[model samples]
Structures are given as C-alpha cells and as structure tokens.
Target: MINKKNILLAAVIFPAVMAFGQQYGGMWIPTELNEKEMKAMGMKISAKQIFDPAKPSIKDAVVQFDGGCTAEIISPKGLLLTNHHCGYDNIQSHSTVENDLLANGFWAKNMGEELPNPGVTVDFVLDIKDVTGQILGNTKNLDAKQAEQVIKNNIDVVSKSFKTEPHQKVIIRPMYYGNKYYAYIIETFKDIRMVGAPPSSIGKFGSDTDNWVFPRHTGDFMMFRIYADKNNKPAEYSKDNVPYKPKHFLPVSIKDKKEGDFTFVFGFPGRTTEYLPSIAVEKIRTEIDPAMIDVRDVALKTLDEKMRADQATKIKYASKYASVANYWKKWKGEVEGLTKSDAVGKKQHYEQSLIAKNPEVKTTLDEFNRLYTEQSPYALSRAYYSEVIRNAETLSLANNFYNFANAAESGKMDAKTLENFKNRLTEIYKNYDPELDAKVTAKVLALYANRVQPQFLPSGFEQYKDVNRNLQTIEELSKNSVITGRGTLNGATMYSGIDKVFEDQNSLVQNLKNDPLMKLFTSMRESYLTKTDGKYAEYQKQIDVLQKKYMAQQMETDKNRTFYPDANSTLRVTYGEVKGSNPKDALYYGYQTHLSGVMEKYVPGDYEFDVPKKLIDLYNKKDYGIYKNSTGDVPVNFTATNHTTGGNSGSPALDANGNLIGLNFDRQWEGTMSDINFDPRFSRNIMVDTKYILFIVDKYADAKWLLNEMKIVK
Candidate 1:
C-alpha cells in the first residue's frame, strides 16, 4: 500500500542513531536490566539493589499512586512523596472557600492530624515474574480471537497461583506486543492520608502557561503517609492503624548535581509507543491529534473565560480545566515535535533498514501500512466522538440517562440499579455548572458536524445543518431537557425517592424515551454503536496481528541492539543525565531553575505566579541552610535526559548511588513527543530538586517534625 521510494526518502532525511549506542530512551523492565550498560553510564549500585524481592530494594519503595501516578517511600514510617498535582484531587476534595487548603497550604504537625482519604490507595510491587511461557505456550495454533481467550484464561490461572494477602492484587500484563507477559504481585494499602502540601502558588506556580515547559520554578511536591495495621500489614482507615514500615526507603541527598551527572528514574510509566510504525505516527500527528486538540482548545478557552471571571467557578473547574488542558497542550507539542524531529521519517528509516535486512518482514509492514491508510478515517472520527460527545458533560450525562431508560424499557430496571445510577448522576452534577456545560455542548457538537465525515456523523446531526442553527437547537434542547428537570423529568418529586421509578418502569421508560434530549442522544449513540462498533474492533484485531509481527521482526533483525518493551502502566527504570537541551538553531535551555526565578515570576494577587510571603522572606534572607548549592543558590527544578511519561509524575530521580536527588514531575513541551518518538537531544524530564524541597520544609513551612523523620544526607 505504501511506496518504497517514500520510505527510502524518509530514511535519507532522518538522522539515524549510531549502530550501537546508549540511547537515553526505553522504559526498561527492572528484572531484565542491562547491568553492563548501567555500569557504563555510572551506576554505583547493583541491579539487585534496584529490584530484589528477597532484599530491601528501590522497587520496594516505589508505588503506583492511586493507579495513575507514582509515589516513593522516603522514610521507614511510610512517609510518601509524590508530585503535588498527583495529590491535587484529594487536596481539592478537602478545600472550601473558608478553609481553602488549595489556595493556602496544609500541614499536619503530628500523625493524629493527618487527613484520611477514603478511596485513595497506594500499591507496592511484591514481585514481578515472567509468565510468557505459561500464557502463550499452548496457543501456538489458535486464531487471534481464540488465542486471546486462552491468554486471558492463562493469566487468571497465573494470578491465582500466588496466594496473596487480603488487600493484595495480582495483574498479568502483556509486554513487547504480547510476545511476553509479566505477572505482578502487588499489595494495596487503603489507609493513605494527606500530610502536607505547599500552597498552589508554590505547588502550581506558573500553572497552565508553564505546565509542559522547562525553566520551571514550581515546588510541585506533596506529602502523604501510608497507614497500616499494628503489624504493618494493609488495612482500611482506622484510628488504631499505624504508619507502614517499608522494606526500603530512599534517603534524601543534598549533593550538588552538575550538567553531566548521571540520573535514573524509577516509577510506573503510564504509556509509550516508541515502536510505532511510520504510517501510524503520521495518522496520529496529522489527523487524530488535531481534531482532539481543536475540541479541547474550544472547551479550555470557554472554561478559562468563566474561571477567570469568577473565583467560585475557578475552584469548581480548576481540576477539570487542568486535566483537559494537559493533554491538549501535549498533543499540540507532540505534533510540532514530531514534525520538527522528522519522527515519521525516522520510523520509516528504521523500518526500511529492517525490511532490507529481512525481506520476510515485508508482509507485516505492508499490511500495517494498508490498514493504517484505510483506518485513518475511522480513527479520526472516533477521536472526535470521544472529544465532542464522550467528554462533553451534558452529552455524557445524557448517555447515562439513555442507558437507564433502555434498562427500563427492557424490563431490567431494579431498585438497586436505579439507586446506583442516581448516585452516579448526583456525583456528575456536584461540580457541574449547567451554563458552562450548555456552552461546551453547543460548541463541541457544532465542531463535530463541521469536521467529521457526514456519512459517519451522528444520526442527530440530520436535524440541524449549520453551526449557528445547531447552536440554537442545542440551546433549546438544554432548556427543555428532562434530565435538567424539564418536560418529562420536570417532577423533582419523582427523583426524591428514585426507587419509586422501579414501580412504573413502563411509564418511566416511555417518558424518558420521548424526551427530546434523550431522543437525540439515543440516536447519536445508537448510530455510533451500529455503524462503528464491530467495524473498529475488526480493524483493531488485524492491526494488532500486524503490529505484533512487526515488533517481532524488529527484534530478529537486530540481535545486538537491545530491545526494551514499551511502557504499559508498569514499573520501569529509565536512566540518563542531568543535562540542558538545544531546542532550535540558536536557542539553548539550561538544566536547572533557581529560587531567584521564582521571585522573578511572582505577581501580586496572581493565581499562578503568586509566592507565599514566608517563602519570600526566607529567600530574601538567603536562609537556605545546607541545602543551598555550591553556587550559593537554592535550585528549585532541574532537567534530565531520563525517559519518562505520564505515570512517572512523582517518580524519584535517583543519583549514581541510588539516593533520591529530585522528584520527576514533567517533560519538556518539545519532548512530549518522546512518548511516540524519543530523540535524546531534546527529550528532557523535569524534576523538583530535593534541596529545594527540604529548604521549603525547613525554612518556609518550619516542618522540622517531618524533616526529622527522613534520612537526609548532606
């Protein structure tokens, strides 16, 4: 499907890496580490020191925080350190206008004052074992569908093989395009409590404007404690619980780090696609990312306007806005970075080289290219559907109502089901602003109709033809939507005791189905399911087969070139150096930002740039203590070449001796594309320096009690 000339041309343009060189990329598995390469890169600790179930190792200290981010134990008493943003939701839940912990700061002077969070959890890796043989040993001759079922069954058996503790969990995850599998035995601690956080002025300094950028001065660290039963076993929240005694905890290092200092990050990296084919990369950069970015840009602009105008709205939409803006800016930067780096060309170059050496790989590459070209439209449409429909609060809520109505019509509605759905709805409406949601719904649906292919457009789009007309229709629909207490759903009495809805399921079902908004949402959702469901699934299956073959072929062609599996929300290690970056022809970015930069960016009454008075006074007096660097400056944040991603938010940036020096929080905007295509030159992971963290704890917060608990090394 793709031409040889194009691949060759890209190869000619791409700057290929040397045949055998250490790439500061790849999220390597802990057990399968390249000890020789690590030593060459200045590792002072043995591989076993990084991960050994029988011994106290770094892996014992790192945890998957709330399943989305990473956190590390820095004290034997289970004092947890993570990115401030990682603990943002918990901070938000505890914030009120009067006691705005987010605006101010929170610190627990003692263990008894630590605030308990109900659903927040932390999981530690007990052990990770290779289970590829058991998962795939018997499925050599089966079709993809059959093989999937067999693999799942095998995973279940492998998971059950380990008799785990009460709160422990076992997950078997596929690696290297399902060519390998790793079974992880993990223990989840339910009693996680918030201990301290700097005000957003410090924690979220520069905010959205500086999110994925470098030269950052944000504090960006939070403190929490894991509580367990008296025996140090996992337990639910209780006054009787004690601080967890961990097997290993990182010691804080105040040693000065220079540009070439070796650094490695240990954490659960969320996802990466360093092995993506050129065609797939092209589609993502050119089509899917743009569509999603455009929709979010609109949503963010609308939200920003409202948030800036009202403080209440700012508090209500702060987290939501950040979540949306994060990936929106990321996608924008990804597209730019990919183009700038000629990532697609590089991928093509790699593929071309591989195919030249192994002609047998041609079939897989051909199928991959063909499927990619054919599936481009579907992928774009799917992204739009997600951005415009699935993400829009009103439409998403409407879909829930549609589901509940369908259950009623099908005679499957029960009191319990009704109550469950009601609770879910109430949660949705809790932070929801009807006016803002209405505006977003109108704008996004208009974008959907204008951009997506007409044939694949939602069935409801037939009612309105133009953007202006669609907006009017949406306005009317929102005003009359029964879900918002109008028309069929106008009676508040009906919802007061939602269980009563089960009494007349037939009537309720008919009323809900007849509602104008429900009718529109049902039409759109039903059309999507009918038209795209099986079709996309089939395409995905074929793509998977081709991708797996391609991945295997890549390995076979390069026996000497070590291949590490792409990240799949699993524990991994990526090492590099504390270094600066040359982003463009003339511009260069230094490795670190200092406390002086924080003062320079400060703005009075500014939400993002405001600095606390106490911090200012300390900075003014040069009261940094022993934490100050040799240059007589307090370093706040630094950049490294360590390969990292979303879940590495709170990962510990360790030194050559495996001592914690910094906390990984972000990647450079230009390097965000490292997820798909990592070029070490521009890929720098940002971290909050440990010295600055300690300086804040001691000088600003006067948190000597917390500081005394940590093993600080000067």
Candidate 2:
C-alpha cells in the first residue's frame, strides 16, 4: 500500500516543481532562513547580519507599530517610518474642525512641537528562541484536551520564567499550526510621538479606487518618533522623556532601482493561511468572503452618500469608512484572484499528487473535506453576524453597554472601570452621527435578515426584514435610549448623564435590558453564542488538530520541499526581485510608478486625486533635487515579488545590503489573494519609494530638519 520508492522519487521532483511555481515567496522566520537560496537570489548580506540577537542588526531597526502594522527606525534618534494608513487612527485622534491634521497634514518644526500619542507603542523583538521540543515533548502521550492544557501551562511557565528586563516581556507563538513554537522577547516603548504626515491628497492619493491597484503614485508614508526614559528603556509617556536611541537604524536609500534588483521586506506580517486544505480555500473564496463583502458593500454605500453630503460627516466617518472599505475591496479582489489563478483547482491537484505519493495523508485529506462540508453553514452565519455588529455603530454601542451592564451585575465594574467606560463612550460619540448610524443599521440588518438561512437567523430578526420599518423603529428608539444619549439627555447634558446612569447599577441594568437596541444586540449575540459560536469553534479545534497532524505528515513525507510557517503577526523576512507582471491578458505593468503619474491622476478640488499646490509647483519647477532618479522623475511607488499580507503594511522594503529603499504599504489588486494562494506571476507587494518620501518631506512639506537626522544612502 505504501509506495516508498515512488514517494522518494516524488519528493525529489515535486520540490523542484513547487519551488519554481512558488517563486520568490515565503515569509521566513529570521532565525531559520534558507541562506543558500537567499544568497543565490542575490542577498549581499549574511543571514546573521539580518537577525543577530546578540548584536545590533536589521531586526533591531524594525518594530511592530501600534500592535498591528510594521514600522522601521530610520534614524539613530528613533525616527520611525510607516504608512499613513497604518498611523491613521493616531492621526485622526488628534484632528478636529479647527486643526484637521487629516486634511491639511501636520509637521513638527522641532522635537518640542512633536505631538505625543498617549497609548501608542512600538515593540522591538529582542530575541527569538525555539522551544518546540520543550512545548511538545510532554504532550505525546496525553489526550487532546489534556495536551492543550499542558501546552498552555508550558507556555505560561516558559514566558514567565524566561529572563527579561523589567520592561521586556516574552510571548510564545505557535507556528506551522502548533507543530513548532517560538518565544519572542519584546521591549515595548510607549512614548511614541507623531512627527509628520502628508495631506490625505498625497498620503491617500487615489483613495478607494486605487487602493489595491498597481501603477499607483500614492505617497503613503508617515513619520513618528520613539521616546524613552532616561536610561533609554521603555517607559510610560512623560514630557521629560528623551528621544530613543535605537541600536540600529535603516539608512534611507534614494538610489535608482532596476527591474531585477534583490529586495526583502523585514517586519511583522499579520495572519496568512497558506496551508489550508483545498476545501477550506474554496469555502473562503465562494461562501465566506462573498457574504462578508456583501454586508460591507451595503454599509459603505450608505456611509459614502452621507459623507459626500456633509463635510463634518466626512471627517467623522473617514477612518470608519476606510477600515470597512479596505477588507471589503480586498475580499472582492481575493475572489477574483482566486478564480483567475484557478486556486482551488491547483490546490486539488497538489493534494492529489501528495496523496498519490504518500498514501497515508489520504485519510487526513478526506477528514478535511468532511469537516469543511459540515462547517460551512456555521462559518457563514458567524461571518454575517460579525459583519452586522461591526458595521452598525448603534448595535456595537448597544453591545458595549450590555457588556458593561453585565460586568456591573457581576460586581466587576469598579470606579476606574466606570470611568474608562465613560471615556470610551465619549470617544465613540465624538465621531458618531446617529442619523448616519441608523441608516447603516437598517440597511445591514435587512441584508442579514434576507441572506442568512431561517435556522441560523437570530430570534426576532424577522422584524428587520422590512427595511423602511426597521429604519423608522430605530429612529424612534434612538430618541429616548440612554445608549443613544438623545431626547431628555441631548447634547452636552447627555454626556453628563453617563455618570448618573452608573450611580444605580440595578436601574442601569434594568434600563439596558429594556432598551430596544440592547435587545437586538442580545438576540444576535445570544444566537451566535448558543447556536453558532460553540459548534464553529469545536469544528475549528478538530480541524486545527488534524491540520497540525497534516503539517507534520507533509513535512515528513516531502523532506526536500521547504516550508515556511504562515504569518501570525511575527517578525519575518520575505525576499524577492523587483519585478512587475501581466496580471491580466494584454495588460502589462512596470515595476515602478513616478511622480508624473500623480499629476496625471490629479483633479482640482477632487477628494481623492487632488494634488497639493506646493507639490504641483515643485513638479512644474522641476525641483526634484537629490530625490530625482537618473531618468529625471521622482519614484513614487514600486512593486516587488516579496510575499506579504495585512500587517505587512509599513514594513521596510530593503535593498540587498539592508538599506531601507521603500515603505511596503499595499499590494496589487489581483495579488491580494497572496494570503491564501500566492501566484508569483501576479502577487506583488507595493511600496512607496523612499525617494518619494524624502522629496515630499524636503520639498513639499519643507521638513528638511527631519531629513537631516536620517542616514541618506546614495
């Protein structure tokens, strides 16, 4: 039954084929790089130079920005560079009608003028250690549940017992679906300050229409600085804290780039599911992605109409609309890319080949098929519920109040907790427009009621079937609901009443229970918790166990093929050549975009494409200075083959010698499916060329003092 000879032959041939097909993709753990392959692909530096835990290296310059995106320290003074979108929330938090940073942009004339962000942080990975043997050694003979507990216990012991500085912490992450584990010793600096940002017209030039598309000219970089205590260690924000001096900083490169130059992205990349079974991929492509996209489609349409009608509404909903549109557009592209690349068919063929060679994996593959088939409905229901609650601000607020009420009932709501809740509510209402939110809630609820199956629909959601009635009901309910702060507690008085409501926990709980919005939230959440969440989680747990087994088996069976763990918000290195592609038939794209393209797309007074007057003046005057390429144009953005994903935003796209050449921001529209199925022919990570960043700073913004700090590599 086991064809050992065939398996041996298959491993040798299949690896070569797979390598060629995958082509310049793989988010490699810095500790374990394919050094030979990297060098062969034209890396001038050694792997040790890339990630030496004992000394300063490229890894020292990279940080996990604000816990989600990546940013690199570009100067010895901890001048951090990241994408505008990555720093969007922090930027918006400081903006107002009088000082709209998002619209006009902000640049500090001196360090004293730098704006401090209270809670933002940058985490540096001090060291990474492999503790897979320690984690798995004791679990071999245990039951699944017992093994999980043992793993959790081991993780706690490993993390807590690990030697670290007072401010440093250790976090262990499972890789290859728990086949391995790595503990990261991280130093988190909390005193991050915004130094500069370009206006939205430059930072988010093409907006939604050009978000994931290539041949883009968006100058999407933002600047921030890290501050630390006297000893240059992590500390809480204080005015006296000095600028952090980093161990290493990337030298910004303004050198011209060629099509075949070697490039590598070094930073934290978010989640990716490269190893999912064919059935799972298919479900995501067809059922799950489509369902989520449809819900957001409705929400975006409603937000867009209201935003265009009023400037204040636009300012209020800018971040919310962008966040929703991002994944919505990405999912649409993912589906198209999946279909265009024949991802499911390719995965099926690969599975067939694997099973044919190693027959033992057939059982695992069969199990995957069965589990996925059974899990489809639960997955779709979960997706719909998540989208509905996420888009509808009123429902989200209601859910928050319900949780607060429950916490109060459980005696968990202390004075500090109540204060925090009040602050959070204030922040929420700061940008909230009830009229806009009610419209969105009505639309998304109707979609949810219509699309979800009867059995999966939440009880009382039948009332949402009529959109007009739902809108009217929501409007009327909002007038008196404490959660909405309308009617009796209108405007400033409403905010003051927040404290009064909390004074009597019993009355507050009763009021929350009776609130119509809370009732709706309770219905939806309870249905999910009762009917869908548990079953979906259980199925996922089983699938995960099987997947771990599947991973080990595949590795054992195909010894020649190299495997990289999927991205899980960990520091990684992905290398490739600077190149472009014909993502579709009869349409070829170049590797780079120029500033000229920005002007070409510019429309006067347009929201998305309008160019700043200073930038236009510089372009007309041909004042490119040192940032201009040999071809007499400033490089705006470029594309490369490095495999990246969501959290890779603001990652440093480095040259072969480890200089920061560009800021990794977005991906080509057809390549957004790289997270699930990376087709090298189409997958490209877009980056704002460092030259463009410099040009904008020196010429457009006149922030030469900031540039003076950076090590500019010619």
Candidate 3:
C-alpha cells in the first residue's frame, strides 16, 4: 500500500559525491589524525596540533558561565562572553516592571554591582582525550546495538572513575548516537555574574521578522563574568566571589576573518538527527506538518487578534509567539522546500541503488514503507489529539496533585531528585501564561472539531464540526470550561492541584481511567507504538547495516585514514571556509552582515522584528565606531558553512589560528532543513561577530573591569 511515487522519488535524489564514500567530504577532517596523517591529507595541520590545549592555537577564549549558556574567557582574570538571547529568558524571569531589564537592558558597572542567577553553571572544556581503544576493546563479535552499548558502558565506567581528576567533570556521550563514544573531562565554574547587555532595541533589533533570514541586523549578543574560590578553583557563589585566574585566555579578535577564512565552531551542541529516512521526511513535509500548521495558524491568528486588542494578552503571549513563530516559519519553509526540491527523489534513488547492490537493506526499506503506509490515516489524528495542550494549566494542577500522592507513598523525593525536579520546573512555572494557554488549548480543540477525521474526534467535540475554530469558536467554547465538574476534579482539599487529582479516592486520575481525554491519549499512544515504532526499528537496523557497510568500505579503501564515525554527537568537528553563497546564482547571500542590516530589518511593529529607537538612531548616524569593519561599519554580521545543528547554539566560531571570533547561534531559514539535506547554498552558520559582542560589552554595558580583562585586538 506504500506509494510507489514516494519510493520512486527517493531512489535518485542525491549526487554521488554527497551520498557516498568520503568522511572528510564536507570540511571535517578525521579526529584520529596525527601531524603526519593530516599533512598528507592536505590538512593545514594535524588535528591534534589544532585541538591540543597546550598549543598556542588553543586559547582561554571561552568562559564557563554557571549553567545557562556557554561563554568564552577572553581575559585571564575571568571575563565571560556569550549571546544575550541565550540568557534572555533568565533575565526576563527575574525582571519586574519597576526594573524591566529586558525592556531597558542591564549593565554591571563593576563586580560589586554584578547580579547572580542561581542554578546556572558554566563549563570550561579543559581537555579531550581519545579513549576509543579502551571502549572498542573488542566489538568484533558484538552486533551493532550490543557494540554501541558495550562502548557506552565502558565510557560511563571510565568517566565515573575519573572523578579524582582535579577540578574536572566528565560526560560520556555516544557520537553518531552509538557508532562512537567519548568521555569528556571538563572544568566547571559555579560563580558567574551578569556583566553587560545592550537594550532590546539594540540586542534584539528586528526581533522575529528578520530571524533566520538574511539581510538581518540584530546585535544578538551579551557578556558575563566568572568568579573562583580563594584557592583559584571553581566554586559556587558566595559573598567572597573572587576572580579566577586562567592558564590561558583567548585573545579577542575578528581582525582577520576574510571571506575564505577556514572557520570552526566548538561548544556543547544540543543534537541533530541527520539520518532520517526519506519516507519520514516526506510524511512530515506532505502530511503531518500542513495539518498542524493549519491548526496552529487558526490559534495564532486568534491570539494575535486578542493580543493586539489587549495589553495583558499581548504580554502574556509575547514569549509564546516568539518561542514558536520561529519554528513555524521554518516548518512552512521546510515543507515548501521539501516539495520543491529533489531531496526525497534523490534519497529514494539512493536507497534503491543500495538495495540493488545489497538485498538485505531492501528488507529494511520495505518494512519501513509498509509501516508508514498502514499508519498514515491515523498518524496525524493520533498526533493532533494532544490539541488539548493550549494551556498546561491542568498539567501543573495535575503535577501538584501527583506530588501530594507521591509524598504519601514515599516522603518528598530525595533532596537530589527534588532539586532536579525544581530545576526542570524553573522554566515551566516561570513561563506558563494561563490566558494564552487557555486560548492555545481551546483553539486546538476547535481545530480537532473542524479539521480532524470525524471518527478521530470525541462526539462531544464533533457537534461543532465544519466550523473555523477561530471564527466560530465562541458559541461552542463559551460553555466548555477546562474543568467539566468541580466535584469530579477537586474532590478533596488535599487535591489542591491537578497532581492531587491522582491521589484522592475520588480522583480525576481514576476518572481518566475511563475518561474521554485519557481515551484519546491512550488511542494516540497505541497508534504511535503501532506506527513509527516499526519504522524506527527498521531505520535503526538500516543505520547499523549502513554503518557497517560504510566502515567496511573504509577498511578496504584507506586503512591509514583516521576514520571518525559520522556525528553521532558523542562528538563532532566540522571545518569549512567562510564563504558567501548564491541560494541560486543571482539571489546571493553574502557571508558577512553589518549593523545597518539590523536597522534594515527594523519594522515599526512586527513582533520579532521591531528595533528600538535608540538602536535605530545609532545606526542612522553610522555610529558603530571602532567596532566597524575595515570597510567601515563595525562588522555586525559574519557567516560560515560549518555543518552545524541545533545543539551548537552558543558554540564558539573559531578562525584558522583557533582565535575566538563569533558565537554560532542559528542557521538561516533556507537551511533549517539542513539536518536532512545540507545544501551548501543556504546552510551557512549565523554567528554574532566577536567584535560586535565586545562592542556591546565594552561600550553599551560600560562594565569597565570586564572590558579591561579581555585582550581585545583592534
């Protein structure tokens, strides 16, 4: 029942150069590389030489912030640099109308004035050592899954034993998911403080309208500082916070990032699932996303209308809008790109060719197609069933009640778990907006009524079918309050929150055992299990086969080349030139951007694109000052084709000599789908120029001591 058209499309989608036989194909050299090996492979230097901590190439350019985001140490006495947006939510949470830091911005003129945000920690990459020989001690007889687990268990065991390493912490991650694993021993800092930040007008200029788009002009940068214990070791904050001295600090410079400069980014990148099946991509592009977009579009429009009409509503949804609109736009673009591009077709062709060459892989693809075919009708319905999440007000209410029940069963979770729970809930509680939640939830349910299959919707919801949820929602929603019956939900005083609803003998938790909501959730859960579970299994199996095949091919072709497994994110390093692109010949995107571009993106009232008057005035006057590039306006924008993914946010973009030059934050919109298809034309990494970050810190923040600490190259 699988669509032949879909399969036909994937078989011939990619160029041979992109799909086959080259580890260093796109700017990444092997990690196992030595000085001689690298030089022979046309690399400028050995991988070890560049990555070595003691080498002049390595600098203390990074500053470990308490925990919110990564920062570079540009000064020996402990100054920190990172993105303002990375720390935006934190500042916004602590800010009040009387002292609205987000609206006006914050600047710590001196250490005494610096503010501390609790539960935040910064990590410094102290050293990286290869433990591959130790991990793969003997994976010869083990199958893929077993081999991966064996390597992982070994790394965890190794990392745990490394606790004795002075001033260090260890993280064991399996790169390429399981093909490779590494134990990273890092130094951590607990004392970090706010230093300087440009006002929203400047830092967040052209907020959303220009996000992920070229010709952008947002400053998008911030600064912080690190404090150490009296012994010069990392320690938690106290009244005795003192500057920690470093073995080396990165010299702050963007003096030489020419268009052809080889740039690399380093940091704890989040994650990327690059090896998704072509069929899966098609499903997202063609089936699921469009429906979800339609549903959200109605809700967003309704919320936009209300927010525009009321100030409280506007404030309530500002974060919500900002949070999702970026992705929504990206998804819209992705669906469009997927439909128009030859990616799916190419993938199918590639898959078919592989099948023709090796029959075993065909079973995996066949099973994958069969699963997707059987699941399509209900796949979306099951997913959209959670349309109830407009506001997780009930979840909190439920969580609180659950906590009470839990307390009765096992005294408050042990201190450690409790702290973890609190930390996890920090953003949830702070960002929850009730009115907006209600609106988002209600509109989604309304979407179910209008767009979902009749059988998929509960009868209670079916009555309002065939109506635009946004426009004709008031009549049906006027009576559909979040809680249907107080007696059923709030049974006891102890059931103070939704959590306790699970505790009471008369609990909604029990009601949910037979409740429609729970039924929907159950049905959806079953569908997913019966749906993607099989596809995922097949996908993983194919990955195993392909990894083995690729490794086999490598074994035959060049045994001397240090082969690294693809970026399983256990660790990855991508190297590339800083070059501009022609998304298509005439419509080119330059590699670098300027402060004026930020001003250009400033629309008067767009939610994500508004520029404050102060920033606009500065730009109009061509007042970038010393921060301007040699061509004149202080270089506000720069680009790199380093193959980056989501987890790379706050990654330090380094130059050929390994000097800190930019903080990789996001990718352009045209390249949001780069995880699937890494088109060189659009997949450029967007970074806040190191110089621009310094300008904001030194000039805007006026944090003089912090400025003096950094060794800025003019």
Tell me how far the alpha carbon of residue 208 in candidate 2 is from the true structure, in angstroms, after superposition: 3.0
Candidate 1's displacement at residue 92, Å, is: 3.1
Q: lDDT of each model, Cα atoms only? A: 0.85, 0.88, 0.60
Candidate of highest lDDT: 2
Q: List the residue pairs that clash in candidate 1.
A: none
Error of 3 at 442 (Å): 4.6
| Model 2 whole-model lDDT (C-alpha atoms) | 0.88
Better of 1 and 3 by lDDT: 1
Per-residue lDDT of 214-333 in model 1, one digit per residue for the tens?
Answer: 889999999999999999899889999999999999999999999868889999998898887899999989998999999998788878889989999997887678879989989998
Output the better candidate (1/3) by TM-score: 1
TM-score of 1: 0.92
- List clash counts for every candidate, in order: 0, 0, 54
State how far residue 534 of model 2 sits from its true place (Å). 1.7
Of candidates 3 and 2, the better by lDDT: 2
Question: Could you tell me every candidate's TM-score relative to the true structure?
Answer: 0.92, 0.92, 0.78
lDDT of 3: 0.60
Q: Write the residue-wise lDDT of candidate 2 on 556-596 in tens digits.
A: 88665788899999999998889988887788899989988
What would the TM-score be for candidate 2 when compared with the true structure? 0.92
